[model samples]
Target: MAEELLFTVDGPKAVPARRISLAEAGLLERQHLQQWVIDHPELIGNGVKIVTFEFDRWVSGAGSAAADRLDVLGIDRTGRLVVVELKRDRAPDTVTMQAINYAAMVRRFSLDTLADVHAAYLGGSTTADEALARLMEWAEGVSDETLSPPRIVLMASDFGPTVTNTALFLYEAGIDIRLLRYQLYETAAGEKMLSVAQLLPVPDAEEFMVRPRSSSATQAASRKSGERRAAAAQRLIAHELIPDGTSLTVTMPNLVGQDRDAIRAWLDAEPDRARVRWYNDLTAPVEWEHDGQRYRLIGLIRTIIESATGKPPQAQIWPTAWYCIDDGRTLNQIADPLP
Candidate 1:
C-alpha cells in the first residue's frame, strides 16, 4: 500500500509527519477506473504512450467456454501490442493465466491488423494505411517487420500472493508481463488522488534481468541495419528524390500555356505514373516522369526553394507555379499543391 504525509505548521514551530490512509477515500468502481484510464492513458503505466484504447474487446478461446472481453488494448511507441486487463479490487489467482491467454491470442497480429484496431478505435476518422504511416514516422529505427511481441499488463488495487508469484515466474521465464497497483487517495478537502506502481521484476533488479536478453549480436545487427537505411535515405536526399529539406535547383519551363486536360491525359497514359492522393479532393499534387524516374510537384518545389534560399519553405500549401527541366524540354505543368 502507498502512503501520504500531511504537515501542519504550529505557530512558527514544526510538527511531526502525519501519515494519511489512501483507502480512506473509498475505492473506485471497476468501470469508473477503466474510464479514467481511457481518459488519461498515460496513467496506464510508465514508459508507455498509448496509441488508442479499445474498450471491452472480445477474445475467443479454443475450448467451449464463452469469449472473454478485454478491458483495454493499446500499442506502445515501439509498435508492440499491449493488452491491459484491469481488476477493481484485489487481483484473482488466475489473472496471470488469463492475461497470458490474451497475449497468445494477439501475438500473431500483423501491422495492418493493429492499424485497423487503432483506426476503428478512432471511429474511422483515419484509415489503417494512414495510421501505419504515422506510426512509422513516430517510431524511428522500428519497422513493421521488427516489432516485438504482444505485452501483457494486469492492473488492480492489490495483487494476491498467488498472482504476484505467478507473474514473477512468467516474467522470469521470458514473458513480457507486468503488474501494476493503482492506489486511490483522498485529501481532507474531498479531492481524489491516484498513485500507480510497477511491482514486478523489482526496479533494482531490472538491469540484471532485462539486460541479458538483448544480446550483443542482436544489438550489432540492428545497428548495422539502421546505418544502412540512413545511408540510403541520405543518398535519396542528395538526388533530390526525397523531400528532407535538402535544396537543389530544377530549371524547368513553366506550363502556363499547356492544356490542362492534355497534360492530365498524357500523365494518365504513362505506365510508370503512380496515383497518389494526399487528401480526398479533386485537387491533385503534380506528378510527372523525368529521366525515367517519377517525381511529385511538391518535392520539386521544395527542392528548388530550399536550394535557392538555404531554408525550407514556410508555407505548407503548394506554390502556384513551378518549373521542371526534363530532356532539354522545359515543360510547364500545373497540379494541386500539397497542403
Candidate 2:
C-alpha cells in the first residue's frame, strides 16, 4: 500500500507538506510519542482502548528475564488484551520477539491484576472502585476467571522486512498481530505533524477483527446474555420505572477512532435531543424517535455503531450504553431495585 500524503489547503490551493522523521522532528520515544499515545490511544486504533500506561512492573516466574516494560496495555471491545510496543525509528528485528515476549507475559494476567494496574495508573484522579468499574466496563462481559491471549501491536516510524514478515506469519497462524507505521511531516510554516497507518493489515483497521469461535461455551454465553437482557427489560416494564415514551439519550462508553469521532460529532450536534424512546416490547424495547422503528437495546447500539463505522461493533454488553433522558438511569440500573 502507498504511504499517505497529507496536504494543507491555503485558501483555494492544496500544498503538500514534506514528510519528516521523529529524529528530524526532535521527539523522544518515551517523553513525546509514548506520552501522546498514553493520552490519546487512537494513535494505535480506536478499537483497542488503553488500559494502563507504561506497565513495567513484572517479575519473571522463571527468574530468567530482567524487568521488561510494556509501553502500553489495552483491551478491545471483545475483551481480548492488547499489548502495545513502540519505537521512535525503524523498528529493529528484535521488536517482534520482544512484543511476543510481552504478549506471553501479559496473557497470564488475571483480571484482578489488570484492575489493580488500572487503578494505579489512574493516579487518584478516580477512586479504586471507580477505576475498577471503568476497567470492567471496558472489558464488556469478560469475567475475571477467563483470560484470552494478548494481541500484539507494534508502532514505529517503520518496520523492516524481518519484522513485517514475522508479523504476517504470526497473523496467518491465528496470532493477533498488527504493525502501525508512524510517519512524520513538516509543513511550510515549520510546524510538525504525524500520521500512523496499519502497514501489515494495511488500510482499514476494522477488517481485521478478532473472530470468536463457535463453541458450545460461546453459544451458551450468548443465550445467557439474551436471557439476562430479556429479564431486565421485563422487570423495567413491570415496574413502570421507564414508562413507554420515556425519552432516552444514548450513553456511549469510552470510545476512540473514527467511528467514535463520527458518533460524537453527531451527538454534540444535538445535545438536548433524545434519539431513542422506550417502547412496550420486552424483546425490543427501544424505539428510534426519528424513524419510529423498534429494536432491542443491543440492536439500537449496533445500528448507531454500524451507521458510524459502516459495520457492526465488536460483541459487547449494550444494556447500559443508553440511559433515560430525564432520570439518567440505565435499563439495568432501573431493573436492579425491582423485587
Superposed Cα deviation of residue 2, candidate 2 (Å): 3.9
For residues 91-198, what per-residue lDDT tens digits would candidate 2 score against the true structure? 998999999999888888877677778778887665554455565455443444334577789999887767776775566555768899888899888888888888
lDDT of 1 at 138: 38
Per-residue lDDT of candidate 1, residues 199-256 (tens digit)? 7757443343322353455435534443322211222223434233222223323432
lDDT of each: 0.52, 0.70
- For model 2, the stretches where C-alpha displacement exceeds 4 angstroms are 62-65, 125-127, 203-339
- TM value for model 1: 0.53
RMSD of each: 12.5, 13.6
- Model 1 is weakest, by summed lDDT over 10 consecutive residues, at 330-339
- Candidate 2 root-mean-square deviation in Å: 13.6
After superposition, the stretches of candidate 1 with alpha carbons farther than 4 Å from their true spots are 1-30, 51-66, 141-144, 203-339
Q: Which residue pairs in candidate 2 collide?
A: none
